[model samples]
Target: MKLVVQEFLTLDGVSQGPGAPDEDTSDGFTRGGWFVPFVDEEFMEIVDGWLAQADGLLLGRRTYENFARDWPAMTDHPNGAIMNGLPKYVATQSLTEAHWDPTTILAGNIVAEVDALKRQPGRELQIHGSARLAQSLLAAGLVDQLRLAIAPVVVGRGRRLFPEGSTPAGLRPVSQHTTKAGLSVHVFDTAGLPSYGIYEG
Candidate 1:
């Protein structure tokens, strides 16, 4: 199984609280739900297509809670309906019991558990809006592909997708598309040598 990580981010690389203003205010972030107005049918079509191809969903604790309360109540689609019914793996250290149906807390090491999931024979394991989890997975060299929807506006400051302290890896752009609002959907697959290309002469 391949791990495909997807995220909707602002041009300034802010991925926190894309769904709610009060969801995460850790850093005095008042601009939440910035991606809501830009969700056209064309964008929704792209999202629906991706959601349809998932074998399972991987989520961080906060994203899991958001999805658990929202997806089941969202509009019914053949694919979206199936996603709500599939098993979701949540990476959490504090969660012992799940409040939502078909949810599992990762018990072992994050890398080990995700590695086991990647080894299983199944469809692509999809991840969405789990920035912290994605950071760990990317650092461990477990993510197979990245689907990023870069929104138009910039938030100037917020939580970044890639934090400090991680080995560098090469990324090859496999595909690209543009949304109606000028958001670039870049798809990159891990490829080539994992080395810094620039060095002092």
Candidate 2:
């Protein structure tokens, strides 16, 4: 199974809370729902295509709990059925009882556990809004592809997708498109470790 990360970000790379006002207010993040204005048919089509190819979900505790609470009840949503039904693998040590059905907790050595998941036979093990988990995967070089919908807004401060001190890696853009709402949707393939060089001009 290939591990793919799909995320919505602000112009400044903030991925903290793009869904709702109270989606993720951790650390006093007041700029939630920054991606709401960029929603359109093109955006939905792109997102739906990604979700359609998901064989399972790899999520962090916060995202898991949030989705488990909301998605299951949103039968009317376009992607609710898939979100509720797909197998979810959560990385956490504190979650004793996962109320969501078909949830597997990865307690020890998340990188190893996810590595095993990638070896499994499946379409794609997708990671949604699990910023912390995404970072860990990225550091371990476990993510195969990344699909980012970059909104044209800057939320000054929030949990960013690519933060300071993150492992540097080379990425090749496989595809890119601009939505009617001015969102830049890009798909990039991980191109191994980054290389350094100094240009003399």
Candidate 3:
């Protein structure tokens, strides 16, 4: 199984709480549900397709809490229905205390655990809205693809998916499309060694 990490981010790279206002305010983030305005049926259609293609879900502890609390209750929505029924792999040390059902905790070594999952026969293991988990996966070269829904606006400051000193890899674009509402959805296949190019000359 290949691991695909997906994120809905602002042009400035803020990935925290793209759905609800009170979801994550730890960084004094006031713009939580910023991506809702740019979403249309076309955007949703693509998301639905990704959800259907996933063999399992990969999440961080905080994102697990958000989905565990909301997905099961969203039976009326198609995307929610799919999310509620999928098997989930969570990255956390406090596995014994987490309350998410149908989830397996990754405790010993992050790379080894995810590597084991990849060896298993499955469609694709997906990570959604988990910046920290995504970073770990990226650093280990375990992430096979990146699906980014880039919204138009830029929130000056917020928790970013790829923070400074995390990883400075370049993504090779495999597919992309800009929505009618100006949202750019880009699909990138993992490429060469993660490198940083700084101009000093």
Candidate 4:
């Protein structure tokens, strides 16, 4: 199974709370719902395409809990249906029981567990809105592809996709498209480690 990360980011790389004003207010992040202005057909198409290719879901505890609270009640929505039905693997040490159906707890060596999951027979394990888990995955070199919808907004203070101390890796852009609302959708294949060079005069 390939591991893919799908994210909605602001111009300044903020990834937190793109859905609602109160979605994720951690660290006093006041600028939420920044991506709402850019929601158009193109954005929805990209989101739908990601859902269509998902065989399962990999989530952090916070994201899993948030989904468990909201998605089950949205059975009528196509994306909600897909999210509720897909097998969800959560990486956490604190969660004792998961109320969400078809949830597997990945505790004790998360990287190894995810590595095992990737080796399993499946299409793609899609991850959404799990920033901390994403950092870990990137650090471990476990993420295969990254799909991003960059909105034209700048939230000066918020949790970013590539935070400080993140792994340095090269990314090869595989595809890109721009929406009328100024949202840039980019799909990138993960290249191994980054290379450095000095300019010679």
List residue ranges in candidate 2 displaced over 4 A: none
**Per-prediction backbone clash count:** 0, 0, 0, 0
Overall lDDT per candidate, in order of appearance: 0.84, 0.93, 0.87, 0.91
Candidate 4, residues 96-124, lDDT tens digits: the string is 89988889999889999999999999899
Clashing pairs in 4: none
Stronger candidate by TM-score (2 vs 3): 2
Lowest lDDT block of 10, candidate 1: 74-83
Query: TM-scores for all candidates?
Result: 0.91, 0.97, 0.92, 0.96
Where does candidate 4 have its weakest 10-residue lDDT segment? 41-50
Q: What range of 10 consecutive residues in model 2 has the weakest lDDT sum? A: 77-86
lDDT of 2 by residue, 1-201 (tens): 999999999999999999988999999988799999999998899889898999999999999999898888999997887888999999999998888988999999999999999999999999998988999899899999999999999989999999999999899989999999999999999999877899998
As a TM-score, model 3 comes out at 0.92
* Top-scoring candidate (lDDT): 2
Regions of candidate 1 where Cα sits further than 4 Å from its true position: 75-79, 192-201
| Candidate 2 clashes between residue pairs 3 or more apart in a chain or in different chains | none
RMSD of each: 2.3, 1.1, 2.4, 1.1
